[model samples]
Target: MTIGIEYLRVVRERFAVLKGQGDKTFAQLDEEHFHWTMNDESNSIAILIQHISGNMVSRWTDFLTADGEKPDRNRDGEFKMKRMSKAELLDCWEHGWRVFLNALESLNEHDLVKTVHIRGQAHSVIDAIERQMAHYAAHIGQIMFIGKQIKGEEWANLSIPKGGSDAYLQRMLKEK
Candidate 1:
């Protein structure tokens, strides 16, 4: 495959991995736990979801034709604490991901070299994609950290457990 095709495939795989981590974290949390916060200034999982979803929608819709930051986006409002049911939160999450993944799927090799705008700043399509990938990954990390903090000892391991590296390696070898 060409480099552009390979890059796109790799980017999609990385995004899928990030989303899987988020899904696992969400599964381990109760509705109430989604609102848990470290302090008044800190964001809860719900707030993070709101912010991430809002960002995804704004940045991905008309990704190449229009500026990434939509005119109607309430970037500041996303950080405000709002009480939403777990179902509502998940719906919001799904909507954002749908828009984002669709946009990513629609790109072609030629489009990679095209320019896009975010907040009036110019970026090549590849650079724009990398920017969003980094942004989403950072937020996902925050979600995972918050989930782990609330679940504490009850949190299911997302990757190898503290001392399971040898066993995990052995299992992989066996599979091979």
Candidate 2:
């Protein structure tokens, strides 16, 4: 498989893990918790989701053909708390990922050489994908870290549980 395709797969899988981790983090929290900001400078989980969803919809729709910044995107509104329900939040998250995955599936090695514009700046398709991957991972890490802090001892580990990594590694090696 081409590196581009592999990167796509990896992003998709990472997205799934991040989504699940975020959801698990929120499962115990109330709507107030979702909207809580540490200060004026901090964005809540709701804001993050909205921003991510907006980016995904704009960047992925007609991905290779159109500029990554869609004319319809409201960049500022994303920071506002729009959806109050967890269901709505999850829906927005899924909507973005579905669009992103569809666009990734449409890509081919030759398409990597094609240039696309984001905020009027030109970038090759592969470069754009890599950039978004890093961006998403960074945000997701923040989300997970905050989730853990908010939940404290009650927070469920998203990956291997504390003290379970050795056993998990042993099991994986045994399977191999």
* Superposition TM-score, candidate 1 onto the true structure: 0.97
Number of clashes in model 1? 0
lDDT of 2 by residue, 1-176 (tens): 87867766776687677667767776766666677777889988888888887898999899877889999899999987675687788788889878987887777768888999898899988789888877777777777777776778987777899789999999999999
Please report the TM-score between candidate 2 and the true structure. Answer: 0.86
Sliding window of 10 residues with minimal summed lDDT for model 2? 14-23
Itemize residue pairs with steric clashes in candidate 2.
Answer: none
Poorest 10 consecutive residues by lDDT, candidate 1: 85-94
- List ranges where model 2 is wrong by over 4 Å: 1-7
State model 1's lDDT: 0.94
